[model samples]
Structures are given as structure tokens and as C-alpha cells.
Target: MGRLTWIGIMVALAAGFSAGAVFGPVLMPRPGAASNPNLIDLSALPDELREKHRNEDFLRNEATNYAHMQEALAQRAAERAARAPLDLPNGMESVPFGLVYKPGGDVHWPEGMTGELGDALEAAKDGWVILNYWASWCGPCVHELPEMGKAAPLYADRGITLIAVNTDPMRKDTPDSARALFASKGIESLAPYVAEGTAVDQMMAAADMTMANVSLPTNIIYAPGGTPYAVFEGGNLSDSPVWTAPQTLAFLDVLAKGE
Candidate 1:
């Protein structure tokens, strides 16, 4: 094969590997999945290419298995909830969420999030969408990230998309840094979304909520059809109404079953 021809083959394989990393881990894509048009004809690739393809498929299957395990664990947690419902702790507001989803409010999507969420939120409109604000400097945010990550697979079960918007870009919070943090913590279920110039104001507007003296590190939940469902303002989950990851898994299970 000519030099350039070999290069083309490698390039195609690289693309497949990267694509596989994204959708493969969660969706558990098969090499011959009918919808995958970009999948190369592996039968023709040299031994090296074939080996890499096999490794990629192995990794993808492993990720899918891990996600399934988390989901099964989540199902068990739901059973526990059925036996004994979770009660709002003292000092926590009785409201299902700090803020209830209001109808027809004008939600100002942050500039970058608009195009992304326009499609994502709409597609997930039939299920659930979770938006969170976080920064590396915030201790609580960092602590909560892993917890949220743990529940992410469960959340994704019913068309859910969890987005954590990074803050303090001016203070040197970049997407890469956030990703590094997540990677360090063994978090694969969610990715850090960069929302430039996003503040409490922008996030509040994005969730179609008015400023109610809430601060950063806000957590907002959306019900099916992209409607604002609830907002759990910042605080330590252990000490506040913000549901812990396990609690949320149970809640989402109950929700998906319409119980």
C-alpha cells in the first residue's frame, strides 16, 4: 500500500476509536450495528488495525457492563424505597424541590448551551434533563461530583442527560481541567460542559427561573418534555435537602415507573 493510503486507513481507525469511546461506552455499539455507516470494513484491515479494533470492542463492552451493574444496583435501591419511602429531613423544605416547575416561563438558554440543549433538551424532552453548576474551587461541588457521577448511569436509563456546567472560567476553569478532575475521580458517566460567562443569573434563566437570591452550585431538574421540574439550590447534601446520589437513583426509579 502507498504511504498516503496507509495513513488514510489509520485516520479512519482513529476516528472510529474516538467515536467508539463516546457512544460505545454507554450504548454498547456492535461492529455490525446497522446504523453505523462509518464503521470500516475490518475484514480488509491489516493485523495491527484488526487488533486495535478488537481492543476497542473489548473496552466498549466492559464499559457497557459496568453501566449495567450500576443500573442493577439502582434497581435494588428502588426496592428499598418501596418498602420505606424517603422522607424529607428536618430543616429541609417540604417542597419536592426547592423550586417547582412553572409552566411557560421564558428560559434564556446560555449562549453556548442554546444550540446544544436545543437538540439535547428537546430530544430528552420526553424524559429528564439535569443541569448542575460546579467549580474546582468549590469543595462541595467537587465532593458532589463523584456522588452525581455514581448515579449518572441510573439517570441515563430513561432518556436522561446530566450536564455539569463549569464556572469561574476567568479563574482558570477550563473544560480540560474539569475533565481531568472527572477522570481522576473515576467518573465516566458524565462529562463537564463548558458554559462561558455562566453565572447564577444565566443558569437561573436557562432553567426558566427568576432570581430568588440563589447562589452558584445550583442543581436543576427537568421533567419529560423539557419542562422545568425542580431546583435544589446549593448546600451540603449530607446536611441539606439536596438528595444524595443513592437517594436520587431511587427517586428516578420511582419516577420512571410512574409510581
Candidate 2:
């Protein structure tokens, strides 16, 4: 099958997997829980203690919900692994991958460096490239930012570069918010790129990927010469096991050694 066609299939499968696993009945609130106005019996508690009790309950509920989600995600990942191995396009083993940077788009670096998207990618073509597409609005994307930050230096030592592209629209999702998030998450090592206009759309289209169809926190792994090797989409706990830092590093190691 053609590359785009294969990507379409993968997208469909990922959507189905998410629907079955992440957004299944487990996520539904208990019957009457949402409808009941007095679910919390705080009427007898003192005013000073009521807020504390509510906060404690909120934290407890959050922890439980997060655990359930993680379990579901892990199960989905295992099911995906049992079904098929991650395979790229045929003959892509030799194809040189490179970024199709959209000219006139602004890209910002942590060190206060600013430049066009194409120039930055061209300058960093000497090593394995992990092009991560993210947005501030995506919870999973925000959660993975810190992990990506922590892994960047280690990957850089092994001749790998991690470029985080903020796909938030300039008008609604300001660059300031992106920068703030990077700083808040302590993302020191990963360079940040801001997408302008249809820059992200153009880049994905060139690589036979579509943002609308794929999940957020999408990542494109490119070999040293810029040839795209793998496209991993969805949350960190996604069925695509390559979403983890270890898996990503292992994949990069294989590419770096030409294995």
C-alpha cells in the first residue's frame, strides 16, 4: 500500500483503539453521580473543614481516575503489540528524510535564538531528529513535555536532536503560552518551534501525515539524513508503545548504528 494510504489505516486503527480502551465505559461517571446535586455530604462539616475535605476528595478521585486510565492504556498497548510490529514504508530504509520547513514561519529556541523553521532544521540535520508536534491545550502532550526535556540531553550525547513543534495556532494559542509551559515544565534541553499559519499542516502533508486524523502529541522520527522512519501519534500512554522515552531512545540507537 502507498505511504499515505497506510497512514490512513493506522489512523483509523488508533481511533478505534482509543474509543475501545481510553474512552470506554470505564470513563463514564457512575449513574446518578452527575445528576445528583448533593453527591458530597459536606453539609454537616464545619466551614473551615469543608474546603479541606473537598480538596482531599478531589485528589483521591483524581488519583483513582488516573490509575484506571493508565491500566487501560497499558492493556491497549499490549493488545497492539500482539497484533502487529511497527513497520515503515517499503524501500524507506534508504530514503533520506528531511524536514520540509515552511518559510516565513517563526521558530524560537530556549536560548533566545529565533529563526525560520527551515533554517533551524537544516542546521540540526547532522543527527537523528525527533520532531515532536504538541499543543498547550493537550493534557497528555503537556504531561510528556517534562519527560522529553529530561531525555533530550541524553539523546543529544548520542547524536540525536529533539525538536518540539508547538502546533497551537498563533492567534488562540500564543507563543507566550508555549514558552511559559516549557519553562513551567522545566523543559531545558528540547528546542521549541512555533508553527505559524499552515506551516504544521504543510509539513505533515509533505510527510503523508495529517494532524486532523492523527492524535495529538504526534512525533516523527527521522534518521540522521532527515529521512522519516516512524510516525508515532497519540498520548504518552497510547497504544503506540514508541511514545515512551526508553522506546524512543532505543529506536534512535538503532537508526544511529544503521542497524
Candidate 3:
């Protein structure tokens, strides 16, 4: 055979081998689950381009799960909402006290203090004293003050004394505003006083150290002997779920009739 003829035969053989190898995978794309054009139509890509996009969707999903950006954003929003300000008292800017419950109806008063309030607290008598620490700018105090005003008169004959302490930290406009607000609202029953100088700080310190850290609108109950019965550190009287209608009546009952 001529040399050119041999070379042509070899070339022809190589072409046939290449055609079979290419068609082998095309005939069977791994058997199970036939590729549906409507589902994942990849007819548009050449062989080299097809594999790149084959895992594109899977990679995108993996990246999303890895970052979890959407979930992080949602959590951040919730935190911000929770941190939003509540109506604080004038000259103050924090929720220093938390809710606390005392069992068995006993109150522990500050040692070495003796006065009307001190006497009432120590006696554990049926009568109850409510020490309300508030400020002019506090929204929660404003909301609760009216309820207290009404309740005070209603229970006046029952020996329930409502003392309102203004914890404005300074004799600024805040305390003045608070007093005016109370007067205008006809809160005549409250024994109002400005807790200026060190009084406010002292009370807060006492609460934190001895009385279970309390705040404005704090309702502390005592037995006749000056022992703490219960303490309610919450928002407006209407908003605090700690005292129910029946509980309120019961508390009043103890105050009015207990000795």
C-alpha cells in the first residue's frame, strides 16, 4: 500500500474512535430519572458550558444557608424593638427595678429608721402604705398616677396611705412638671414630696440592696409590724397583671380589716 494511503486509513480510524467515545455518555446519562427538558432544559449549552451551570443553583442555596443574612436581620430587628424606650421618670433614663414577689405577707424595713412610715412598716398592722417613686417625664408613672389617685380616696377610710416620692434627681422642671400634672389631675390624696438631694438615690440604693430593686409606681405592701408583705414593680396600675381584681379586693380587705 502507498504511504499516503496508510496515513489516510490511520486518520479515518482515529475519527471513528473519537465519535464512539463522545456518543457513549450521550446515549445514557447515568440511567435513573430521565432528564425532562421542561424541568431543566440545558440544550442551550455546549458540553464545556453545561457543567458550570449544573451546580449553580445548588451553590447559590448553600451560600444562602451559610450566611443566614435574612435570619440575622430579623433577629436584629426584634432586639431593637425590645430595646425601645419606655416612658421613664423625669431626670432618669433607665429601668432600674424589676418585678418581685414576697410570700407569706411579711415586710422587712430598713434598720434603725423610725418615723411615721417606719412605724407603719414595723407594726405589721392591718394598714398598708404605698410608696410610689415617680418622675415628671415618666410615661408609666403618669398613666398609673390617676388610678392611684382614685384608689387612695376610695380606700382612705380603710387606712391606706399613698405616698408619692418624686425621684427627679434634681429640682429641675421635671419635678415641677410632675407636681403640676398631679395637681391638675386632681390627685389630692397623694402625699407628694420632692425626693431631691439624696433622698431619691437613697431609696433606689435601699431597694437595690435590701428591697429587691424597685422603680417608679412600685407598690410595696407591709404587715402592721413594718415587715414587707409583697412588692409590685411594674408599669401603670391598670397594666400590671400581678394584681387581679380579686387580688386587689383581697389586698384591700387585709388593709381595711387586718390588725
Candidate 4:
């Protein structure tokens, strides 16, 4: 199968895993009732105090609900595990809920890093501009790193500029650690930036949910006008077809031609 085709599969499976995790709550945190210091024993309280204790108990129950939900989810997962293998595609593992990809949102470029990257994009006299959002911790992102690096220089020679927009907030909080990780991984094409003092949720809400996921290696190709032309929503670059698929090169060619 072609690399793009594999990516398509990954996208589907990732979506499925996300759905299951959400509806199933397999990875929820179990907060035992004892963990909540504010939990009240209504039986020991007087009439007036009982009412107040009931309110506290209500809040405590909400907290414990997560724990109870987690326990239920664990039982379900164990039962499923005893059955056949998880039919998920290669290079994909189940992720927590609320991390699936949805589309139609705008890309959130950090204001500080936007100047250089945007300027680079605008400077493209001809050909398309490819902006890749990636992070080191992302598995798929790591897999795509080398190919993207190669593609960047190749596109540059063709008058197209491929700029990797690093969205890892760790760069701000731990510059040394972040830089070391990037350098160790040989991610030279990615320009690191820290999105500080900005709300990622707001930007993502304004942008497409299809672009966001719990997985790594989310890539979006933009045209010269800063509009999205194509998107590889999920899947790691190291997976089947990504390393050798001609379709990968074909898309790069399309970008080179500015189509």
C-alpha cells in the first residue's frame, strides 16, 4: 500500500481508538473515596450539619465518580484483552479520550515564533509553503522527522520552503532539555518555539479538530496563500509505506510545482 494510504488507515484507526477510549473510559484515573479529605460522614452529623455534610458528600462523590468509572473501565478492558488481538493498525496504540483528530480549525501559530516562520512562508516567491507542526514526544512526529528534513532541503532547491513549526511548550520551560531532545534526534528542520502566555485551546477551537490528536506526526500542508491544501491527519512516518512510498514524493512534487 502507498504511504498516504497507510496514513489514511492510521487516521481511521486513531479515530476509532479515541472513540472507544472516550465511551469506554479505559484509562481513567481511579480516585478512591478515601483520597478526598473533604468527604463527609453524614451519619455522624447533627440535623443542620447533616445538610452541609450532604453537600460536601455530593462534591466528594463527583470526585470519586472518576475513580469508580476507571475501575469499571479497567474490568471491561481486561475482559477484552483476554479475547483476540486488538485489530488496530500497525504503529498505533490506544490513547486517552479527548485526543482524537477533528478538522476545520485554524492553525495556532505562537505570536513570538510566527514572525520568523510566517516571514519565511511569505517570502516564498513561488511554490507552496509547507508548515509542519510537530513535537519530539510524539511518536509519529519522530518517525516523520528524517523524511521531512530531507524534503525541506529538496523543496528549498525547487523554490519552495518547508518550515517545521515546533509546538513543544517544553522548549520554554526546559530549553536545555528540549533542545537536547531535538538535537539528539537529529531534527534539524524543526524550528523550536514555546507557546507561552497564549491559550492553545482557543487557537485549536478556532482551527480544525482533525488537525489535533493524541498521537504524533500531525502534518498539514499549506498553499502559498496560507490556506491548507492537504493534511496527513495521523500515522507515524516510520510506519509502512511512509519510508518508501512514492506517494510521499508525489505530494512533495505537487508542493514543488505549487499546485
Question: What would the per-residue lDDT of candidate 3 be over residues 135-156, giving only the tens digit for each residue?
Answer: 6655666676766776666555
- On residues 151-211, what C-alpha lDDT tens digit does candidate 1 reach at each position? 6666787556777776542346776888899999988877666555444346546744332
RMSD list, candidates in order = 20.8, 13.2, 27.5, 12.7
In terms of TM-score, the best-performing candidate is 2
* lDDT computed for candidate 4: 0.44
Q: Which scores higher on lDDT, 2 or 4?
A: 2
State the TM-score for model 3. Answer: 0.47
Question: Per-candidate TM vs. native?
Answer: 0.49, 0.52, 0.47, 0.50
- In order, candidate lDDTs are 0.53, 0.53, 0.47, 0.44
Query: What order do you get sorting by lDDT, best first?
Result: 2, 1, 3, 4
Considering only N, C-alpha and C atoms within 3 Å, which residue pairs clash in candidate 1?
125-225
Q: Is candidate 3 or candidate 4 better by lDDT?
A: 3
Give candidate 3's error at residue 91 in angstroms.
41
Candidate 3: 10-residue stretch with minimal lDDT: 1-10
The alpha-carbon lDDT assigned to residue 211 of candidate 4 equals: 24
Give a tens-digit lDDT track for model 2, residues 1-259: 0011112322343332222222122232355575443343445656764444445444455455555555555654453344322443333332212112221112222122245566777777766777777776667677667777877787777787778877652235566777787888788777666766677566555434454333355566666666655655555533232323464466566666776
